[model samples]
Target: MARLIDLSIDSDQVIQHLKHEVKLKTVYQSILCKQIIEKASQERGITVEPEEVQAEADQFRYDHKLESASQTLEWLEDNLLTPDDWEAGIYDQLLKKKLADSLFGKQIEAYFAQSKVQYEQAVLYRILVPYSALAQEIFYQVEEEEISFFEAAHLYNIDEYRRLACGFEGKVSRWQLKPDVAAYVFGAHPREVIGPIQSGHDFELLMVEEFIPAELTNDVRQQISSQLFDEWLESELNHLVYSQ
Candidate 1:
């Protein structure tokens, strides 16, 4: 029997597949977001120059280790994208970035200043267990130097994968913690042990290592930009839906 070669799928087939997989809503939202960016950027005269798109594409290719044109083409083939499709994607991303900066760049510093306290970070080691009695036992053991926080977490934490991490939740911000837990952890001094407190189903014992004062670092700037852009996008999307 002869073999069938390289079957092709059309846009309608792709849409049908998305619907079948119950992913049409997610794909639809993404398409709407792209349309929003294109329209809004054009209105604001936020054009993404060819040079900018080329630079972005080069950076992307470098990031993905696609060093040569052949390697890039192979990658595009693997990802089911043609050169034009990939270039258009890079252009779309650059346009969105320019639009986001134009709309929210001036407001980031003010927003960061307002939310500075929420960005304060803490380094803590934790031991969490199912019961309070065991937690109290571990607390005393740790307090008296009979056992270390790391050792207790290694031995007793029920979540095996998290046992490693519970021993070191590196640089968690105030926003990341529950309000009650944040209050205790932030108030405690360095090297202080606090908790065996009720955390939903588990009792958690935390040992604070250090506190990091919030600063407007580059990472935080990028975070704020993304955050503000997402908020704007969601609001625009909601308005569009409601008006329709």
Candidate 2:
């Protein structure tokens, strides 16, 4: 390893950067994931085809708007990656995807069927206030028809974007929210006002404007497949008992 960077960078700064990079949680996970994917690929006889690699490279070039081979080379230089490293990285990614699909593809439909409620989305309006008393007051006002949820949110909610949007949170699935918040929101009837529920440091009043039941669209199925694959990876990683 002939010092990845030149002498222009201070020795102490380079040491510090290396130390920080190695210690990052994402870096650790990426290394573990690579190890797991390689093992799985071997066991399952999964492979990266030349056509697949070329297709991925083409898509990458299109995404980065690299109009020519020179531009692609410039990008590799800027990223400190050689052509071999770039192609190997692409192969590793494709291998992982192939391995996951091969291992978990058949389980997706069953998993989706069992956990479909987690994917159901709710269109919501919320009024969040710092104090429990304020949240309760807003809830009462809305309940009594003295004020609408949107009006109260505009007047008192601390989040500026939500206030401007009249407290609309667009649509969110149960898995997208904190456990406590999701429990209340998903269980409540549509158009029913609910909550003075504690959320972190703030208290919130939420109303479910509408609920969108989960459907097994192609996109959703793919998402579910990825989720299952990730969960399997985590469990596999956890059970590896290493000894020096």
Model 2, position 82, has a per-residue lDDT of: 88
Compared with the true structure, all predictions reach lDDT values of 0.88, 0.85
Candidate 1 ranges with C-alpha deviation above 4 Å? 1-10, 128-133, 158-166, 197-203
Instruction: Show the lowest summed lDDT stretch of 10 residues, model 1.
Output: 1-10
Using lDDT as the measure, the top candidate is: 1
TM-score (all chains, Cα) for each model = 0.86, 0.79
How many angstroms is residue 160 displaced in model 1 relative to the true structure, after the best TM-score fit? 4.7
lDDT of 1: 0.88
Clashes of 1: 0
lDDT of 2 by residue, 31-104 (tens): 88789889989988888888999999999999999989999998998777888899999999899788878988
- Candidate 2 collision pairs: none
> What tens digits encode model 1's per-residue C-alpha lDDT throughout 89-118?
989988888999999999999999999998
RMSD of each: 3.5, 3.5
